[model samples]
Target: MELRDDQPMQHEIGNRTYIVADVDPLDVDGVRTVEVGSALWLLGFLALLPFYGELEANGRVWWLWACLAGFGLGLFGLEYCRRRRKARAERDGLDHG
Candidate 1:
């Protein structure tokens, strides 16, 4: 089958057909999930700050640092996904145009 630029690319396996597009629904969901997770991590870190001394004394200071790291990684992943999606859109536009 000829893939048409004007239509979404599709695949058929067995009896199921799947449509592939530049902007995937799952990608949007993933981005949203990452954003929420990142916010939660930051908030958790902040909320636990008052007990930092106790946590450190108990040798569990890593929790705060881990949360901070997770927040940073999440933000990075979100940006990366967004940029990748944008680039894919641009490429698709150029290809179809």
Candidate 2:
């Protein structure tokens, strides 16, 4: 059977290939996921900090700071990764001229 040229074909000349709408895996890689993952890890680590307290209550409450630090690091990493990716895209001429 012959395929019509006007119509969009599911397969190309030789092989049958599947077309995916979301082709880029890192398309959604950004500050959001990093922040969330860091927050979770920090929270897990902080939950064990209570052991540092003597007589049930004698140590510094650093879990809050830990969370903040994780947040900051996540944000920074997101920004850095974004800029790096942008630079790469620009070098590759992927960005709109």
Candidate 3:
């Protein structure tokens, strides 16, 4: 894991060599973030519903539908990430069925 000075990622700035940090990526599975996003999109759709008439008149009604679509897609992503996290945990012998 040691990076040499000749590595492509090594940078020399003012006689100082900067190399990429050796760190493991996060494994939070992103379910919480997806839930938050889905909630926000749902809230946006609900908030815009009251102004549907104005939005349609101004030809911006797609914004509301877009929010709904985002919420729906987020729902799918949430389930997918949750399943992935659970599978990983089970495979690692961390969480038993």
Candidate 4:
């Protein structure tokens, strides 16, 4: 895969080459985002484990639990979105054949 200085993405696989101009190109950005989001979600979940301690030390706040639940939901949503995109791409490939 070739990322040209002039063009956004100029990649050659086998004998075929693909070129895309100045836009959010499809290569590694999505993968990186997914990885980062997954890590954040994991950390958020870990944060929940310490919430009990925080509750005991300070007063009670249900928002902490809500935030943790939201993070878990976000993780699931991200995974679902990624899977859906991959499944659509695969289906498209099969449709061409």
Candidate 5:
């Protein structure tokens, strides 16, 4: 079904219902990208855990730190974007489900 810009959208899957705020599709895409990027950064940090000792010994632990920083920044960006989208939806009177 086509979604209207003036209203929130609702969908049901099995026994669960989902209420979605209406926002630009491109903004949603960007949020997804941030989420995925954050996950990847976290994964990279975890992958480097086993080599932590060696990296520290070689004074190259900055790589792991960089990944952690990226993960943090990505998470912050994700939340910021999500909030902005929600606020925009609310301002447009599309927040009610």
Candidate 6:
């Protein structure tokens, strides 16, 4: 069976038919997401700072370090996503001033 370009996907498996929506994906560049994530991670690390001694006593100090790592990695991801979004916009002629 043929489906129209704008039609949702329909798959029949076993005794059930699944219909997937044919909606367009969001055009987010992910820079904001990364920034928010990085901020959250930094917040988590700061919030855990006061309990550092207890964390070290319990051998869970890695949790704080993990948050720092997440923030660092998110910084890298933010830059990459920003560059990717710029390139995509330029390619699609959506970078108009």
**TM-score for every candidate vs. truth?**
0.63, 0.44, 0.76, 0.43, 0.65, 0.77
Estimate the overall C-alpha local distance difference test score of candidate 3. 0.91
On lDDT, the stronger of 2 and 4 is: 4
Q: Residue 79's C-alpha lDDT in candidate 1?
A: 90
lDDT of 5 at 35: 91
Clashing pairs in 5: none
Which clashing pairs does model 4 show? none
48-76 per-residue lDDT for model 2 (tens digits): 55555542364444655666577678777
Instruction: Rank candidates, TM-score, best first.
Output: 6, 3, 5, 1, 2, 4
lDDT of 1 by residue, 2-59 (tens): 7555874788999999887676334342667788989999998998899999999999
lDDT of 4 by residue, 1-97 (tens): 7765765467888999988566775543154465576677667657766677777577655656665666677677677767766777687684311
Worst window of 10 by summed lDDT in candidate 3: 2-11
Q: How displaced is residue 61 in candidate 6, in Å?
A: 1.9
Off by over 4 Å in 3: 1-11, 19-24
List, residue by residue over 9-67, the lDDT tens digit for candidate 5. 78889999999875566545268789999999999999999999999999999999999
RMSD of 3: 4.1
Q: Which structure among the candidates has the greatest lDDT?
A: 3
Q: Decide which is better by lDDT, 2 or 5.
A: 5
Evaluate all candidate structures by whole-model CA lDDT and list the values in order.
Answer: 0.82, 0.62, 0.91, 0.64, 0.86, 0.90
Best by TM-score: 6
lDDT assessment of candidate 5: 0.86
Against the true structure, what is every candidate's RMSD?
A: 7.4, 9.8, 4.1, 10.3, 10.1, 3.7
The lDDT-based order of candidates, best leading, equals 3, 6, 5, 1, 4, 2
Worst 10 residues of 4 by lDDT: 25-34
